[model samples]
Target: MHETLEIRLTVNERSEAVRIEPRETLADVLRERLSLTGTKVSCDAQVCGACTVLVDDLAMSGCTFLAADADGRSVRTVEGLARDGRLSPVQQAFIDHAAFQCGFCTPGMLMAATAILEEHPRPSRDQVVHGLEGNLCRCTGYEPIIEAVLAAADAGTVDEGVAGW
Candidate 1:
């Protein structure tokens, strides 16, 4: 049996120390240890993007990341995006555009979209599509997701659109 490694992770906005086996995945740590189950684990191989989360502001697959690898890194899941019960712009855009259907893919989509907007605050349609290419939504057919990203970029606030709600 491999010895557990003491790892410290800044999750959401709280600091926590967890003992993780060297082989344990970040997704497991987040779900099983911290109880932040919003970060779903679908493709353990890291292709589906269903396990995506923000690591140091970059979108990364939790399933592919070792728990120890996240030591000293700030992790943000979908649960962290909002403040005081208010949804973030990206999240709000998703709601406004009706971007999700089953909602299983929304977390990954939001993570990817957040990363994309970090690069291009106001991305073009093509750029939006390109940025979100990594995330897959079997239900929405990609149209609503694209529109939601654009809408979030445009409205400048997920709750307040370009028209400033």
Candidate 2:
């Protein structure tokens, strides 16, 4: 016999009530249960930031973050970065700077950048580097990604059109 718990969470500005097992991770629940695949699961050990998502406005590793911990909180995934069919500033900057190659790490990078921008408003290059140090990306070599983040900060509206704050 297995035990399950029901949790209510707000994801991407949408409320979701789900029955989940005690051991289920937030990444699995979000990807499988809610069909939000943007929160990718790479190194489930939290070494890589591929599974990063904003939980209550703070960046968290979704793979290691238990679903139960997300109950009663607001979650913001890569899909929630935009507003009204428009891409968030960070997302647009990524595209403009060619920040991604394989694109697997784009979602996580974007999320991390968004979180940092929200917290610091205008982050320096070193601050951006320090903030995103946990995220690993082999495709774009991080130069473009860093530039994208800086450009996003320069846009001065990184947090304007986002959902879930």
Candidate 3:
């Protein structure tokens, strides 16, 4: 029998009811089902933060999170970070600092940074590095990314509504 699982999920502050396969990953559901393509999938094994998404308030690897596990929970992808077409401060800082290139890692980087800033608010350089340890960016060097994060923290310019920080 073809089983259709009904799952209710919150994305970008909007609730959705979806049917997914038992084995489908959260990333799959986000991208294919919900069309939230901002969440990328690199290494599906959870080592790479490329598929990172906020599950509740914790950063999680969406590739490993089952769609069923995410049911009725809030999931935030990079797409959800912007409000009314305005980018969040961290996101704007990223753009202002030119922290990304090639862009494969941007989504995960943003998610990781969001989690970092939320936890630390004003994290040390090492803490920033440690927070983003799992995320890998092959295009831009680390300096720009670090600078961007520091700038966002220093400015205290984060849109509280966007990140809830």
Candidate lDDT (C-alpha), each: 0.86, 0.90, 0.88
Q: Give the alpha carbon lDDT tens digit for every residue of 1-165 in model 2.
A: 799999999998899999999999999999999999988999889988999999998999999999999999999999888877888788889999999999998899999999988888788899999999999998888999999999888775545544333
- Model 1 residue 63 distance off true place after TM-score fit, in angstroms: 0.8
Q: Name model 3 segments beyond 4 Å from true.
A: 157-165
Q: Residue-wise lDDT of candidate 1 within 3-81, one digit each (tens)?
A: 9889998998799999989998889999999999999988788788999998888889999999899999899888888
Across residues 68-134, which tens digit of lDDT does each residue of candidate 3 receive?
Answer: 9989999889998877787777898899999999988899999999889888888899999998989
Off by over 4 Å in 2: 157-165
Better of 1 and 2 by TM-score: 2
Backbone steric clashes in candidate 1, count: 3
The candidate maximizing TM-score is 2
Ranking by TM-score: 2, 3, 1
TM-score of each: 0.92, 0.94, 0.93
Q: Which ten residues in a row have the lowest lDDT in candidate 3?
A: 156-165
